[model samples]
Target: MSMTPPPGWYRDPSYPLVERWWDGTAWTDHRRQPGSVPVPLAPPEPAGHGPDRARAVALVAAGAVLVTSIVTGVFVLGRNDDGGGAAAVRTTPPATPSAPSGAAAPTGSSTAAPHSGAASVVVDELNGITLSLPKGWVAPSDVAEDDLVMTTPGTYDCPGDPGLCRHGTVASRTVTANAERSPKALAEQDIDDAANTAYDRDVLGGRPYRGITSHRLLKAGSVAVAGRAGYLVRWRVRTGAGPGGYVESLAFASSVGSESPVIVRLAFDAGAEGPPLTDMDRITEGIRPTGDTDTGGGVGSSIGPSR
Candidate 1:
């Protein structure tokens, strides 16, 4: 027989000074990794896993030194009409496994619309999509029709009672659809421009990437998506630690339709800690245009990210 750790933040078994989420049931996507704020302890548990998030540059080997100039050179420009809190999986990307030192990232059992802090399962009706989201991962009220933002649940460094995670999009996800480059090129470009470097340094830090180590494209290749062309990438970047972000990302993109060159993506901040995500690939692979994208074809149809 096995004993499960009580629901709360605990010291990540893999990394020191990190915290993980155990929502009274299973491990979650929340982490308090290497460079997060003063790690807060979870409900009566030790700091078993920390909650930290990261992002960076392009085409460089994972975790190598990258110059800010290079990031600016090939970085994807322009932001889509986004809601906020972008987050990741597939091949799937590499990550610390699930917790209680053994359990896996749990699959939610809710089929109803999310309310407050319960686990939510939301479907994009216009797109024929189904998302098995974490508790509090609900579409934002101000979300655009083409974009989606969900409330991420995790224990933050904030002093709080036990068995609770008040953190929302501080480490969140943004999924949007539009005519960007193809999945391959767009995956490469998204890293350099914002996802890894700028978003962390400029936007979050009120400055620029410290350029300690070059952001890394750990892996990139093709995936099998249902009704669309799919490409997957794994990025290793330390977007905010001023050195190397203790972050791991698994980004997936799809070029829908045979007429136009359009791309849809699952993007976000994932920490390099235990209790990693599960079933994310199935979620990404299941995406479609709600019908069909009348694209022009080819991976070079556009210049930069959609404005």
Candidate 2:
């Protein structure tokens, strides 16, 4: 006997947007309350004769009223099949439960799930080149064997002749020392004296390699590496193709944690035309001491001898 609105009726549009009432087959005065039961319309009188006809009419009217109420509620709930109703529903998705106060939202489905865009830093034990790589990046065995490392969108290729390596190429080399040598002396030898060196040249996959023209020093800094004091020097150099291509070279040296007295790293990049200082900072930041090191390494090593 509850009275609900007809198929389409609105009592208030700005606030609660309440619905009007329906009485059997027509509108009625049975008003609805905020939390009270709805009142149905007055019933029809009994007809003459058997009274069966009146009962049937009344039943039909009641059925119509119930059906109209259901349809009206569904339409009001924004579940109508009309295009506008669908659009409204889409714009207003189901409300999401709020998280408890001061609790961080859950991360990446589960703790086991790897975070998107997460990069793991891997340091090469031999050359000490640290690579920041995504989970999917494949580390080639050959480069690992050669003590060379690179990130995705990059690959390391060791040449029988490293001097002829191509553009965008990065290369490194090892050198021997007479005695325990500090990183500063080795860096100076590589940059100023050009001794015990490795060079990178420009080469495209299917194109001939180009030659370098001039080499100029840009910036120099000192950092610790692998439990020993180290020095880092960067340089800007010209290429063989006239005034276009350039090269960046970073050389680092440090004692190899009680293994070797000193370990030297000479990294070069071909086809880099920017100021030498830019790549210098990048390569310097990549150098990290594996163990505790002296703050300043007691000044740079003298250039007297390799030892």
Candidate 3:
């Protein structure tokens, strides 16, 4: 009677330079280089003298004999062809991940060139703008359609709900729907929508902040962004749950020679755990045209201090 070999790594019939995992029943996809440390296998089932155990053993023995014969034949043939030595195995490397279905493939660099002098920056090719990433901030893993968004490094359980929440977020996008509106008009008009989107209900109908209870205008004034005239509106929003935060909408004309306006939205939770409120002004000061040489003019020309 043939005896079955226990589950272990064995010479791969297909690749002479590597060993494939055998689980007693069949070959697995897992493989490793020759002479490498073997992976631990599952412990064998306890032996028994029952009729069922005998039958199982008999079946396993038969299967093992067949597998051994096949593997021996392949190994002998490989050795004979190579004059008694292992043959080289060529493997194709994994391909890079492509964009998801229906999404445009990214073109050019996603990050701004280091000429801006900022420690780090994120480039929005669609809107032809770039925003500086603060020390504790990072580029978002996923961006909305036509919008560039950045947020603080980690997520936390939202105080109002069980959903994931970030302490701070800054989003930039072109005002395509109403391109003709002035910067001041656009800033004033978009502040409420920005606040609602940030603290009220999310896109999936989940109330992360339990909805906004009240909001008061904190600052409204003209500013210069990327050397273009702009306007910003800030508001202190009180949510039905949590220690409500601040939101701001800044609108400016595109510096990419387009008549379209660009809007940067800001949101920050109010607490010691949240990002410093001063980062709002610093981020605003860091905004610039994608390829502009001068970074010091645009946001420094604010009419009043940011709160």
Candidate 4:
């Protein structure tokens, strides 16, 4: 520890233009510049002086302690060579927090881009899928297995609701990287599943009309989606009361980039046998990945589920 100066006035070593009070161990904020009249902290007690002089010295010492204790703040604006030359003041810098080492910054694009499907009639920006759904079709909330559900508004004869139904639903759930099936096999399997009663009961939830009477794979062929060779199969399904219903279904299978090989099934059946879908060609032809970058993929699905 350095030697403590006696508690008294001394010229400040750092600033030659001023004198400061050394409170022994530390430098006090009390300061004075040259050519200024100095205030004697303790006036000399005349030989005849007694209790009165001693009391005055005590009051002066107490005042100095009060001034130093109150000034805890730092960096009070000081007048340099200009005029506002106030006394010396103590100041300290504020502390701030910082990030720790080796932390990775946040990222935006974590999902793989689709190799094709950029030209679809509509696009689901989040899942990198494009669609050519019918007009008045709206995507609903609560999508399962990342599937896209499109619902078209219309009137239909239904068992549950008391009024005419105005909702026709279709879904396409793409399974990527299924090692158990090739593209052709995947397409065939999906088409076959579409024809089954289970797919109707579970997927349809008895919407529009129920009671599937028949389902069959109508055609299977090789096609290209996003410049990648894939297989497509058309399925014909029949549902409802007597002869029930009939609708065409399509399934596609292909590899999605470095990800696993993917197979997609897009199906529609309007409770009853719905007529041939008018927007099918545009949607299928427009299938391409929305490229590697995306802008704003917000809440809600593009097309809603069967309502």
lDDT of all predictions: 0.34, 0.30, 0.58, 0.36
lDDT per residue, candidate 2, 5-51, as tens digits? 32322231111212333222433221122222322232222234464
* lDDT tens per residue, model 4, 203-267: 22333235456666455566555445556666556655323332323334332434334434454
Q: Where in model 4 is the C-alpha error above 4 Å?
A: 1-122, 125-127, 141-146, 154-168, 197-199, 203-210, 240-257, 270-275, 292-307
On residues 1-307, what C-alpha lDDT tens digit does candidate 1 reach at each position? Answer: 2233457554443322334555755555454322322332322222334432111101223553322211111012223334322232111112222323334543321112224543334433322333445433444321111233333323222111111112222111233444454656655544443444323432212233333245565556654443445455545565433233322222333332233332233333344421233323434433343333332221221122221
Q: List the residue pairs that clash in candidate 3.
A: none
- Between the candidate structures 1 and 4, which one is better when assessed by lDDT? 4
Ranking by TM-score: 3, 4, 1, 2
Q: Model 2 off-target regions past 4 Å? A: 1-119, 127-145, 151-174, 177-180, 192-209, 242-279, 289-307
Name the lDDT of candidate 4.
0.36
On TM-score, the stronger of 2 and 3 is 3
lDDT of 3 at 214: 97
Choose the strongest candidate by lDDT: 3
3 or 4: which has the higher lDDT?
Answer: 3
The 10-residue segment of model 2 with minimum total lDDT is 70-79
TM-score of 4: 0.42
Model 4 poorest 10 in a row by lDDT: 68-77
Q: Write the per-residue lDDT of candidate 3 for residues 1-307, one digit (tens) a residue.
A: 3333467665544433234445554443333333434322222233345545434532122222221111100001112221221221111112211222221211111221112222376776655667777777665542221232566643444656434566777766666556456998988988877888788875445677888999988888888887788889999999888888989888887766454777788888887866787888788888787777586635655656645
